[model samples]
Target chain A: MLQWRNSLARHATRQSVSVLFTSVGRRVELMRAFREAYETLGLDGKIVGVDIDPLAPALQVVDHPYIVPRLNSPEFIPTLVEICRQEKITLVFPLIDPDIPILAANRTILEETGARVVVISSNAVALTADKWLTNQFFERLGLPTPRSWLPAQCDPDEIDYPVFIKPRRGSAAKSTFRVSDPEELRFFSRYVPDPIIQEYLSGPEITNDVICDLEGEVLSVVSRQRIEVRWGEVAKGVTIYNPDIIDACVQIARALPAVGPITVQCMMKDDVPHFTEINARLGGGLPLGIAAGVDSPKWLLAKAAGIAVDIPPLGSYQRDLYLTRFDESFFLTKDDRAQMASRCL
Target chain B: MLQWRNSLARHATRQSVSVLFTSVGRRVELMRAFREAYETLGLDGKIVGVDIDPLAPALQVVDHPYIVPRLNSPEFIPTLVEICRQEKITLVFPLIDPDIPILAANRTILEETGARVVVISSNAVALTADKWLTNQFFERLGLPTPRSWLPAQCDPDEIDYPVFIKPRRGSAAKSTFRVSDPEELRFFSRYVPDPIIQEYLSGPEITNDVICDLEGEVLSVVSRQRIEVRWGEVAKGVTIYNPDIIDACVQIARALPAVGPITVQCMMKDDVPHFTEINARLGGGLPLGIAAGVDSPKWLLAKAAGIAVDIPPLGSYQRDLYLTRFDESFFLTKDDRAQMASRCL
Candidate 1:
């Protein structure tokens, strides 16, 4: 830990590197991690958090808090570009799924503000945003993904029982169901929009946080076995140094040519990792990887500061590090609400 | 408030009041609220948190943390009784729904250890535990609840197209689905265990935190409009001064004779509150109510210590107070885990 500080100091004097996290909803831990990284590196930086909701908890803690229009609104991109320019944001990170595609699609316009947007390529986003496309991408890479089929491709009479069905493009485990019978599958297929069915792998699920450099080079892969999940976020998890999972995540990062941080989810079937989906942004549980010493935020800040970051080889993070989470609140008074609203573009 | 501190001090002279929170999984805020109450009331107390899972996040902050057998284990009650006697516990509160029934059933044995177990009667638990029974109870009290029927009573041909089917006894929104057609309802009725069908209320949902005295008299009712929910817990909520909701909650409290704090969930339809289900214990979002000035923890501790708590009238809490939540983690080293394990009973 001390080595990085000395290395950064030796390479350059204290520099300013402001970060902008878009759609920063309830990501207080991630924002704090970046703040700590700046402090540890002795860099002058400001963490700016922007969300559509004025009551977002993360906005309460950041150095700069702004309320932006909804992602679908036309003003969303312009507001983000303006914030990046005003804050002198050196690094831009999109925190939510729906924000990724938009940011990636407009990456050039945002980069014009002199900020290095940490988003995957539009091609990678297209492959990841839809579960059906993700399955095809995984298969094309020769990775073992769950056998999936679109609604029209599935034969109700011939399909096996107890499969999983969800929307072709969804997040936060919404509208996902474990269909035990063909009748249920047929009903849910119609009920859920653009449904995709996949074989249910009744084994432990692992979430891999893959860190890549700005050049899209895979640096480290930290595998965490999800113990308990609440609302699609990991409530309890433990870091595991499984070579299979690590290698599979590295392969996925290389295939996607992912920039910054991306999360690859999979389920273990008889000790083999079967890919599920890839989130081309920081995972909700990325804090665990940082705690295990992968330190993606520190590395990202170091790279942005033009300081060489000494990232370890893959699967080098501390294993068996357990993480349990509980809800913490930020109480907003009338004045606080008004102050946040005033920052709206 | 200073009023409570003076009143508690006048009645009791720096008394010790130890609190035991059962199944204390991810209730770090609740535990901290009780700790703050004790400090404000000038009472000496130890907060004891027990969970079946050793990695429970709340355990990391309590004054005494212990691991116990599962609620179904025959040794569960015996272990709890032993801990209460050992720690000289003054008040007991169960944090989860399943734990409520077990603790209510074993209230006599637990209270025999000179601790007042803050649980409602077994009848109340039975009425609240089963969704079907809860609907019946609400209707019997002349309260407006969503029209509901057990799977056996529902005729597929006569039922409405859009409705909800969930397990007859379930919590945390598990296995709950909105059926849009007869085929979907028929499939889900068989899919969900002991399914009950209810009219799907289309309006916004509201959760009321009702605080009652030891004698089962309602003191305060705090209603919060659920702006957003994640995993059945309120993520973004705003306190609302809905008189109809307040009166309905007070009526439900009087009918059930709630002993301590209970949560009443409902959805508004055409501006009328239609009751859903009642949880016969403190709500997960009770912290918002406390912050809004209900202060149930302080009231409970004051009552337990024989102090006259100056609780205002029903619906007295500050309205329009917003609450937003984010996950916070507790990191346990290997040594911390071993220390917690050694305290297991």
Candidate 2:
């Protein structure tokens, strides 16, 4: 661990790197990870959180927390630009899928303020947002994807039972359902709006936190098997060091014009990996990869500081590491409370 | 049900009203409720969804949907104004607690474009945002709130056990817990970042859907018993006619300079209600009140449209009504997909 941490450090032109997390939600782990990165490097920097909800769990952890506005607001782009300029933010990243395109579309606007918006590409964002397009993306790359179809394109007779239904453009596991038979599918079709039905690959699910650089080169691939899930979020998971999964993730990073962190997800059936979905930004369980020593946050800071990151061989992240998520509390007091109150007022 | 819906229609002067839901997340039912109110009133209007998420479920239901920025963004205020101006929106309401102040603070910017922000006074926003101040709010009103204290203010030996530890300024049930003894309290205190230990009230919980007109007068109060809860949100619930609870809700509405919809929570012990928290915006289970005929949406739209709304008599709602929340689907087709795609590009 000691050698890995030191060898990971490399030569680069140091820049005063300040970071921002948009729509931070309850990402307290991410907040701590970035803060630790700055503290470890002995860098003079700050972590800022931008959230519409003032009471977000992550907001209380950062140096600067602001209750901004909605993503659909007209001031959305301008507001982000202003914050970037004012905070001297070197790197701006978003945790939600929808905000990716907004920041990417406003790349020029944010860049004008001398901030790098961490996103793959506009096309990647669009493809990832639309499941049908993403299926095509996987197909073209010769990667396995379940037989997916929109409601309009589906024939009830042709569709195999136990298919999975989800919102065509959904983030998180909120609107996903598994149907067992034609009757269930028919019943669901009545109310399941804007449905995307895919063949249910009832295999072990794997989450690959794929770290990429400015040149879209894969740095380290950390894979975990989401054994138990609640409400679509991984509640219990164990990390793995699968070579095939790493190769797929590496290929995905190489294929896409990705920058910074991109999350890859797939399911392994009969020793073959079938890709399901990909997020152009960081995944919720990224702390798992960071814990296993992927160090995406520090790498990001290094990039923002114009320092060359010394990445290890792909799939070198620790194997058989385990993680479990439990509910916990975080508080904001004194100045934090004052700032929160001031925002409300 | 028909008479209740009919009784809901009251006196109000009509104005050209367009509404926006900021930080709209997955509140699809709330969006549909507003649209239903407009259609019921025979009024020409539009319901718009503004969120940082490109694929918000609520966004697909609205006539207009835009991916806005985070509230912490410096341009949050200005971006909202631009959307209001471009969409000709007249009223902007926030469903999230933290966003209330953002809109209230930017009332001037929004009003410059002839838009009326649906927020209470900034002071009220601040008071309600801080749980400690909210305790004071209940105290001032002679309402029963649990015994709450700051970690620094608490004396371990004198304090009661099986107590609750919540953030002084907590939103939702994210950072809350029940401690059985000093050992657990001490252990939790070490981790629960900002601790606000309160005398745990173990009893039946009640949610009061209180509606106030633009004039800050009590319009209606509908109470429900949270029979079953999952992950801190009410899953199965039933409505009841409780006079004391209604009286308490009325007193709360009368006490605060509230506008639009406000949600009040309490725990009932020995047939008496003790106030817990106040959300100055809409509640998750508000569909019950709407189902029982407290049409706050119509009243809000009327207020925005320059129409006067005459609410029916207090406690004039259905009783013994039950509601079971089931998982279902909401869809977005070509236009929604196209709009989401366009936002990214």
Best by DockQ: 1
The list of candidate 1 runs beyond 4 A from truth reads A1-15, B1-14, B159-161
CA error at residue B74 for candidate 2, angstroms:
61
Interface RMSD of each: 1.2, 18.3
Clashing pairs in 1: none
Cα lDDT tens digits, model 2, A1-345, are: 887766545322355788889988767778888888887765668898888765566777789887777899998888888889889998888898889989888898799998888887787778888888888999999998888888778877777787988887887775577887765566456545677899998879998888876668777789978866655566556678788788888888878767888888898888898998888888877877887778988887876677666778877776665554533333223344446646521
Flag regions of model 2 displaced more than 4 Å: A1-13, A331-338, B1-345
Model 2 DockQ reads: 0.01
DockQ, per model, reads 0.70, 0.01
Global CA lDDT computed for model 2: 0.76
For candidate 1, report its TM-score: 0.94
For residues B195-268, write the lDDT of model 2, one tens digit per residue: 77878877789998888766777778889888666556565566788888888888887777787778888987
Instruction: State the fraction of real interface contacts model 1 keeps.
Output: 0.77
Question: Residue B280: error of model 2 in Å?
Answer: 30
User: Under the 3 Å rule for N, CA and C atoms, how many clashes does model 2 have?
Assistant: 28
Evaluate all candidate structures by whole-model CA lDDT and list the values in order: 0.88, 0.76
